[model samples]
Target chain A: MSALSLHGIRKDYGEARAVDDITLDFPDGQLTALLGPSGCGKTTLLRMIAGLEVPTAGTVTVGGRDITRVPAHKRKFGMVFQSFALFPHLTVRDNVAYALTIAGTARGEAAARADTLLDLVQLTGFGDRRIGQLSGGQKQRVAIARALAQEPEVFLLDEPMSALDAKLREEMQVELRLLQQRLGITTIVVTHDQREAMTMADRIIVMSKGRVEQAGTPQEIYHWPATGFVAGFIGRANFMDGVAQDGRIMVGGVALSLPRPAQFLTGSAVQLVCRPEGIRLGAGLAEVNSIEGRVTFVRDLGPVRDIYLETRLGRLVAEQSADQSRVLAVGDRVHLSLPPDALRLYPGLPVTLPATALAAE
Target chain B: MTVAAQIGPMAEVPPALRWGAVVNLLLWAIALLLCLVPFGLVLLISFGHKVEGAGWDWAFSSENYLRFFVGANWPAETTSLYLGQLYWSMRYAVVAAVLAVVTALPFTYLMTRQSRRAQARWLVFLLATLSLSEVFIVMGWDIILSNNSGLPMLFAASGVTDWLKDTGWFDVLRDWGLANPRNVKFKTSEFATVLTLSYLVWPYAVILLYPALSRLDPSLAEAARTMGARPWTVARTVILPAVRLPLMGTTLLLFVFLLGAYVAITVFADPSQHTTAVSIYENVRGSTLNAPFGAAQSVVLLVAAGAFLVLGQRLSRKSQGGA
Candidate 1:
């Protein structure tokens, strides 16, 4: 059963629609990530769910009760902002106990609850410290503890890790995921970082141009993207313009077969995407789906090597493990393989190769 | 430990640095002379005795201070008139400062929520009003509060005075000293005095509070709301505590400013309720020709202002330390 659902939510700011016809369900006790680039309406959608922004149309139901017009304070949905938004005026303990204190809880009980929450977030002894005294990661932990102190039915976070350093961000993602699971509260996190979303979310909803491009499990979003934008956004993918012709995608006179036959008319314009890791680079044994190319540049990222290749089809990047025995360098001739199972075809205007790839060529 | 080692870096010091130090010392000397000499003269005169005639001679005496605490005719005839004036000074200043700040707090908070352009426009308007001379403001209020043509006449013309009489509020207003036998009168009343004083400082209160309230992190309030705090609760928990120091500091500064107010009190307050500022004016150049006594009263007012300011600072500091 869904714990919270937004039915055909729309928000219009003047003539511009910030969130256009978004309908989604958050499964009970599951963490759903609203993933998008900046200004893609992910934050707006989250605000609408929190009752901070009223939708121009549609209803918001939680556990089958319509709460479309409920105010934010009455909704009691816990939220952590991108800046953490910790109260600098209050001590850590007071900040964490704020919701309880304002809700008319006894002082002694609220203090005890704050201490317990501090312990949960691994900051038990730092309760008396001011917000300014904590490190970025510690502040984020305090924000999480404060939000959860209310024991809200639904928890929301908007880009909670954007303010932290990259190393601390990854650690917090795992830590927050563990905490959310232990509590079993429904959660929605809005973030533009794909790795952060994939690391913490049970399901990821990809948004673009104020619309939901795709919504699925993280694995599904990664391994099987339903659109070119999703394939490019979730992870790195090399794109090539092509035409669907007779059960194959034709790219610059090369007919690349797919695991499944093309589902478009013969002359339909199409775009094909191949993940860099899925492309193999070496002196190949099979001629099927093999292309001759010259290595233009090599980027050695400790565990893997990214080989930039210029071929008749277009500029492509192939990722290979560093442990592979074949050593390739710039200006070296190579054979690149586009495995049928890894190729994804979408019907759309053909996407040009990225400038970085072309510059290397 | 040779002289060369001492002068090692100094030998390379630029000419601009040398000139800068000399200029800085000169500026400090001029500032001290300009700012401190007048106050030093006032202190000196405060201790001097007034002569018999219109002119006074300098002579060390503690009579002025003694006269301020008790009456000039000490044990024979005692009165608390000067002390009472000082008390009214503090009372009116305290109330007006607090009233202006309490009202300006919400107005400033709302103003900060506007766009930068709008905030600038408001600042321009506030500053224009703030720079209006005190004499002009007092004259304006004097007319508006006069019984013959202003609020009292308007009330009579609008039948509000008659309504008050019919509702038995006329007797209550009379008891409060707000009305005479015929109709409502505001001149020479504490209400008129406080109202004009509050209006005098209202713009200043807004200007002083704008920066702190504007820089407040709005996300903190939103975060409070999401955690089940209503708008008022958010303000109490998040906004108020964050700007507490600025609020106290602004109130203290406004209070000090009001302590020096002269024209408004003279124009609006009853003779018995007039403040030290009015007495200072009277003894110096008004009816009484006692410069030394006026200087003494000025010193007392300065001391009172200083004491209150220090007390306010200690309070703000104590609250911050406790937090």
Candidate 2:
């Protein structure tokens, strides 16, 4: 119902800082995702907001009311844990109505409200079953219903879809987004899945190393990642370490230009990022960013074909629509153009992505 | 078809599986020899008659069983002395077991919350304590509870007994038979007996409750808390219900184990309030030398314990069904 804001929040566990000094405001009735990799402190931030964890330093306020000292029980923030955490001893109805019953609502009224919430989650007639009888997705629904039973001002979910199968995760993502929209509650979801964040969050806060890397709309984050880490983390990017020379990046003795001139001191280390789709194959030789290369490998994924190129820019990847008239194959000679508008340039060297990152895609 | 065809795939079973079957049969044989055979002998002996002056005779007489319920004189007289001892046994076991579990529940929960290494250390320490013989523990408690040397002397030395008298609390203790006219007396009372029995089984209670409490997902309680339940409410509504079965099971197991407790009962309880186990020992191996009656008492005790176990199991099952 109201905006939630955190100011200068920092969490320290002995010598290690889990969440550093960070400030952000969650807009009322909008879904914001705290997106990051494993151990990136996104969950820690979410727990602080939920009042399940107290920040070692800083203040949490809801609509200008400081609640940093409040315990989770008093805050009444409905939270869905990664494991769902449904009470196995209770029936589905009781699980869903937990908040209401615990808060002293009449038994019949709480049961009625639980059934209504279950119906909202498309789990009608499942009230009599035990928690152990429900499937993973059903249990998640029960958890969501239980958290929402009190109509909490803030809704928090930590990796809510991580427990579901791949196919079910997508379905529940859309369903949960719709439910959040219908309720119009200020919701914060912490997840590592970029696609999940892009699909559901109105604004995504990308985090790394206990700090916020970038906070913006998903489109903005994808199109204009502020750092090489964000560029590599948000989506697949072909990274090339180079030196900024006169508003351009020189990688492996070849120069790449950006739409806007790179604002870095000349001869300083820089990283050039270009989405695979941003590279165009078979560009005219006279084009500004054109380079000739041999196709090292070809991957045809039905809708698109990713063509890996051995170029002066150090192993560039270009994605072409599958329906194109000319299909490039391995060992084919191709002229690729790194579109100046699509190339994103950031100061410093490119991040070294884990080798398993490629397989995860 | 040849005999090989008749034997077929069964003969092709893996060697490991065959060895497992052999081991299982050996286990069953050992169980029958070590458990069932002795029980069968006791039951058989229980039905025999006890000789007046010497050892028992193997005769098909129901007098020993009748004497357990009523006096041997039957129509001429009736007494419930043995039955009273059985009652004391049941009462002490139930009370002590309940006490042990009640006290251990909080300790075990707190212990489980500790770091894994700390929990392991505590468990190892408890298991080491279990190695202490019952006689040793009883002797230790006996010295501690002795009037001249231990708690009573401390009470007198510290002026606590005088303080109790000044505050008029000494009369309350006297009314409860926990104090004489002058000072507190713990010996020859149900309080000492129950306390010692509960202490004897306390470590077992913690060990029994450890797995259930440790395996409990902490997030369940956290979820309850976030749902507006206070800490106490969370414990009552979530933790207690989740471990209800384990708690009941631990209590019942301790109850059954304490049923035949010999040393603690003999040392702490008054002679008039002695349990069935003490009486059985007295009849068989002590001054009475009545082996048949002892065997009869043993059978009755075993049946009583088994009946209570079955009853507890059924009650837990019914509660589970209701939940």
Candidate 3:
């Protein structure tokens, strides 16, 4: 049985539908990230699976048992909130043992269990300390220990690393992922940070406007985005509005040949999406499919260098690892390559053309 | 009368005192004299003796304290009557304050969870009720709980009293001093006094607990729920523990406020069950012309109230320091 399965779950807050007909299955013993921007309802979807929210339409099943109407308490799914939410009054031990103590376990057993769970999160001797005494990372570890005390069937976290500073966030992400994998508990995380999702999630579901645009592995999401929103949201994409024709696509007045003919009819409007890294750069007029352009700017991000160009088609960015031999300065005329395999086609509309598309070279 | 936190260890006049040094010194001298006058009078009166056919005479005497503690003729005669009144004052204050705080806690939590606009509306309502005169609240409860009208009348009119009588539950009500032989009654009873006193401080309890409960981080309780706690468990393990200090502090505050309750006890308590407040009122202004004895009782009440306040402060400090 899948660890948790949500079937056509829909949640509507009055006239507005916060989560629109989301059907997702979290595989056993793997962490999945519901990745989206703000107001995308990724957090709402996670809350529903945790039973904190009641779906307007459809059922939630965990371990093959229908738990659609089960209240949050009975579902017993442990969750870590974005804020860490450590109880201020209780010591770390009492907070971790709360679930067990409230379940009517003996105090000794509950405290012992709490100590072991704290140890699992690498906060053993720190149990005697109050929550306010700990640093942000330690508090986050305490939250994790408290949530994991129940040994829940599915673990849920909502932007759990957002409380940490930029440096610590990346470190905790890998540590948390390793812990999740070792415990082998199915987990779901909701986050807007794409890098964190890509780092921790075995599968990533990209959502926008309360609907899932695409759900797949991080590589699939980054490399083969199924929609224009996914293509734009997952990473930086250079998009060109064009028309599909016989064995080629025409963007503005420039006709580019594809690897094969598109299923889209000729003259049909489409969008051509490609990652910045896939486009190669070299001197003027070096190869086929090379577009003549001037290097308007160059952004050197340490190991990777991005060369911005302005061409007839439009402004576009090409990222290449900084090389010891080849150096392209600003205003240098160059030819940029758009490999056919690296390109994706989408239906063009106003919303899909994000600010990144219109960003100047 | 006492100003809390008025004095600290380190004190030096700052440049913020806009009035020049002489003017500031004069102002402080006047303020200090004015604030000390009433307390000085109370102390002086407590050591003075009432003179027959005259007003009073200043003299050094332990007579007033002895009378307040035991009775006027203590060496030759024994009487515990006045001490019993003081005991009831403490008893009623403790029970009413605790009841008020315990009930106000959940109500305040729910009130805090409301949106800011709703919270503002609630604050207006609570403040309005909180600032209302104690005499008016006593009047309202008196009307509601009096035997001739209100709850008793409603009970009889709705057949509840008859039902209780038929079910043999009237005996229980009678045992609780909440009913008479003919019908249910509340006047001149401990129940009435306690109920009225709790109602008097109920709004105060909410007001005292408001800032603490309102400023409470709700994310903590929601987080506990996410950890698989039931509603009751969340309340017990998360909510209750979080508000313990506020709860104790509010109770102590209400207790001090109720220590000097005047209207409720006078109206509801039996003559034999009258409290120290009644004795103070009698000696100060009513039938008894023993001003010194009344001052002595007032001093005792003040000491009790101050002691409780200091204890509450120490407890709150310990809790916050530990955290």
Best by DockQ: 2
Candidate 3, A1-361: lDDT as tens digits: 7878888989999899998887888999999999988999999898888887899998899878999998888887899998888887778898898888778899999999999988898897987898779999998999899999988888989999998999999999999999999999999999998889999999999999899999999999999999888888877888888888885888767777666677788878888888888887876533555687888899898888888889876888888788636788888987777878778887666555456533422
Docking class of 3: medium
Reference A-B contact fraction recovered by candidate 2: 0.91
Go through the candidates in order and give the C-alpha RMSD of each one to the true structure: 2.5, 2.4, 5.6
Per-model TM values vs. the true structure? 0.95, 0.95, 0.93
Q: After superposition, how far is residue A187 of candidate 2 from its true place, in Å?
A: 0.5
DockQ of each: 0.78, 0.83, 0.52
The collision pairs in model 1 are none
What interface RMSD do all candidates show, one decimal each?
A: 0.8, 0.7, 1.9
Q: Against the unseen true structure, what C-alpha lDDT does each candidate score?
A: 0.91, 0.91, 0.85
Q: Which order, best to worst by DockQ?
A: 2, 1, 3
Candidate 2 deviant stretches above 4 angstroms: A354-360, B1-27
Model 3 chain B worst lDDT run, 10 consecutive residues: B1-10
Residue-level lDDT of model 1, residues A80-128, one tens digit each, is 9999999987899999999999999999999999999999999989988
